[model samples]
Target: MSDPPKGPRVILEDDQPQIAPRLDFGWDQAVVPVVPPNPPSRWSGFGRAAAGVVVLGLGLGALEAANFTAAQFTRGAVQGWLTLGVVVAGFGLIASAGWAELRGLLSIRAVDRARAAFARGDLEAARSEALRWAGGMAEAAPLQPALRQVGSIAELRALLEAGPLAGLETQANALGRAAAVQAFAVTAISPSPGLDALVFAWRGVRLVRQVAALHGLRPGLAGTVALLRRTVFDAAAVAATDIAVDAAARALLSNKLLEQFAGEAAAGALAARRMLRLARVAAEACRITPPR
Candidate 1:
């Protein structure tokens, strides 16, 4: 009789699925790694102005010392009114440059604190800081609307959390675009290039804060990654704006230095669009309304 059919040979191959190694890129992590902000570039307009003033002052001092006689060198008697005027102007420019740099540093710190607050789950603190930041523009009567728009972001956050998602995207798009345009208007009326750049930086910070608030997200490595990604996509526009603004500032000493306003405007528009996209992603990810 034929032997009973042998059972299928036991195949002992290792069938365990391989797992991929974890990457520490900061994405998909619960804790966001904080990266320090880069120091301002030496090529910045303010830096150059400060440097030039220093050189001018040193050159004037050397010339005065070399021509020194028994009599003390008085401002009026040293050279002429032009020399005295140059000395006074150099001091003023240096002071202004220092002040601008200080303000920029302060602004960066304020933004960092706000981000940290949100990351720690203190939404109220985050909102308060943002509102305070927006309040800065309330001093100018013309900027009241922009201030209101900035303040109204809280309402949008509420709506984003509770309202239907059907038309929310449209609302986000419109609001973001409007805010950017308002920023442009405010910058256009700035009294100086220093002030224009200051306003621009503050508005960008506010926009980022507003968008972060909308999704109940905070400043963390993940958010930073998102921002970097958005920036990459719009780098050309942003770079063009920087070049235009710098060239304009360096070209003239007048208030109407931004001859290439169109490029700056385009940059603002692109930034706003990116902010809207960011809010959308955050809202979709969270799925539920954030804590009040």
Candidate 2:
């Protein structure tokens, strides 16, 4: 039976063949990974000045540490000798490193509190910090930060042509006029309710305007993530319009019905609410995105 089975069997065309995948070593791939360049840091002028001051301080520190150590060595006492030999020599290095670290921290801390507030999205705090920072600069027809802060209709037109803020210097000068137009429109409309409500709306708008001015509907430069910023602005504009319209219409309609039946006073309150909503939209648009 074994002998008979030894006869060759025919291979079937439909049978699966033995196979192995060729492995890729990937030796031909480029050695270096491609990565885009990082964006430049955006510190304020005063912040940059402060940064420079810290750097200058480092130079002074080296000489300062040595001089201070030398003075300690010259005191000429057993205690002084130990202070120089043990405490001064080893401790001096420790103290020097510690001092430089502390200075860095203090330098940042001195101004950083306000900047931190700005980061937390407080325009008032940022504006105050900006103005205070500007006050320290030499008077030269007001820098951008200064113009941005006290930028009443007058200063915006005059000092805006050129100055330190020349980075933003462009036909965007039209932005200043746009903001002024919004301001003027408000002034002309004169939405008088009373002293209390008036103050709240005014302050709210001012805060809104400050935020808008700094963050316009426009994005930043190319590769600056400007497009992303503009996308955010577009989203905000669309969302804001949708919200404002809904709120305003509802408020107006609710007030009309409420006054007709329930209470007339309720109508005015709702109207004020609607007015503020519109004002926020107007303020944000005025400051950030000019009507295109």
Candidate 3:
């Protein structure tokens, strides 16, 4: 009977029960397929063919015209030779401009590749990319000695940031600050919202171009458009809450001056914030080794 009554008595452990370890199913590690899910459309193929045909036709027509002009000149027509010379000179200029723009685009791509290499901690790749990028810019001449002495990716990056990149950053900051202040003033004083929009748009584009130039990127029309698109998208990705909080703080401070100016002040603050964000994004986009 005593043994039966004591049978229910049990000892409890002092330590807490252990939780089962989480099992990783590796869903996040799924690799993307090389082939797209959707097949190429026949319409796309047709469109490409049509474009090729149009380009070929244009080339043939230009060649035919050039030949005709040369033949006329051989037949003693001074006007034909003059026209051919003008045409040749015009083509030469166009070709030079196009080549410059292509070089600029290639420069941009090189910077992007260097940035990617740095992000991935590929030291050799990053070093080579950095050297190639710096070689193209005259402003990097002063850093050439230090660059040659770099033994590691970190050293190279530090040298760049302290030398040419530092100067570029300074210029970019000044540009951004000026743009922001101008945006604020314009938005606060302008009566027309349309005018405010236009001013902001112009300032944004100009600021981006200036920042890019500071980083040794002389983007032409196409490059400018590309940089503008990238900067805008990057700026849009910035935390909205952070911008709102900053704007609110500024608004609160400005409210102390005059309640009458509250609405205009808030609008101006928002515009200024946007301009600043764009400037920063543009700088980052143009940097050889963008911030991690």
Candidate 4:
């Protein structure tokens, strides 16, 4: 009688932010697992040494058994020793390189574990892990206020989830400060220019992906690239920041450039702050929540 029941009854509810499914924050563990290319085996070094010893022994035995002149025998023995020395030196170099590579892998693994802890909402655990690597540098004086306000990983998640625009701005501010300290910590722990670039790139990429995920994006290469493009090209503020950060990080990490400590700190802070802007823009574009 009432126009076929006017379709189904519709109920309206107040608008609110819904808690989206939590994303796994173990990005480093997933992407930067502790897997260094295996160095030449110790056995190879041992074999080289053994071969060198055997060659020396054969030379000595030949010199003792032969009826050659003393000069010829001495010359042959010298050549054998020279060969042995070369082999031994090469082996030493390989061993040194292997040790250095292993140390680098262990350091990266430790960083990954700390990042994983942070992802899983264990701020204290994450902080402790970073402290172990950074030896108090992770908690620089400049970042104390931001860290206090952030309180915990859960609080950060809430800000990402349902907090207002102001909340997102606050989150950005806090995260920017935290990231600055973390970058300094990273550089303190690893002084290599190439290694710093790689580590910071990983950190930056993972952060972008995490924000996208918070806004319901699947973590994948395509999404990450797209969001990065958008952040770099669509948002003027973010784009400007990106340009500035890129220049700073380049200066900070350039082996050819003699960089001062103050310059490095400034570069790191600016890079981090810009990264937060990238995250915010990506999240907003992804529509993590309804527009105000």
Which prediction has the highest TM-score against the true structure?
3
Please state the error at residue 188 of candidate 3 in Å: 3.3
The worst-scoring run of ten residues by lDDT in candidate 4 lies at 133-142
**Residue 170 lDDT, candidate 3, scale 0-100:** 78
| Candidate 4: residue 111 Cα off by (Å) | 33
lDDT of 3 at 198: 97
* lDDT agreement with native, every candidate: 0.52, 0.45, 0.79, 0.56
Ranking of all predicted structures according to TM-score, beginning with the best and ending with the worst: 3, 4, 1, 2
TM-score of each: 0.31, 0.22, 0.70, 0.33
lDDT of 4 by residue, 147-196 (tens): 44667766543443343334444554555456556765776667676887
lDDT of 3 by residue, 212-258 (tens): 88877888777888887777666766647556765676667665566
Residue 53 accuracy (lDDT) in model 4: 98
Considering TM-score, which of the candidate structures 2 and 3 is the better prediction for this target? 3
Candidate 3 structure, TM-score to reference: 0.70
lDDT string, candidate 2, 196-236, tens digits = 35654454444333333333221112211322233345545
Question: Which is superior by lDDT, 1 or 4?
Answer: 4
Stretches of candidate 4 exceeding 4 Å from the true structure: 1-178, 234-259, 288-292
- Model 1: per-residue lDDT, tens digit, 82-192? 555565686678667666556544554565575556556565665565555545422222433443454344553453334333344454455556666766576556567
Backbone N/Cα/C clashes per model: 0, 6, 0, 0
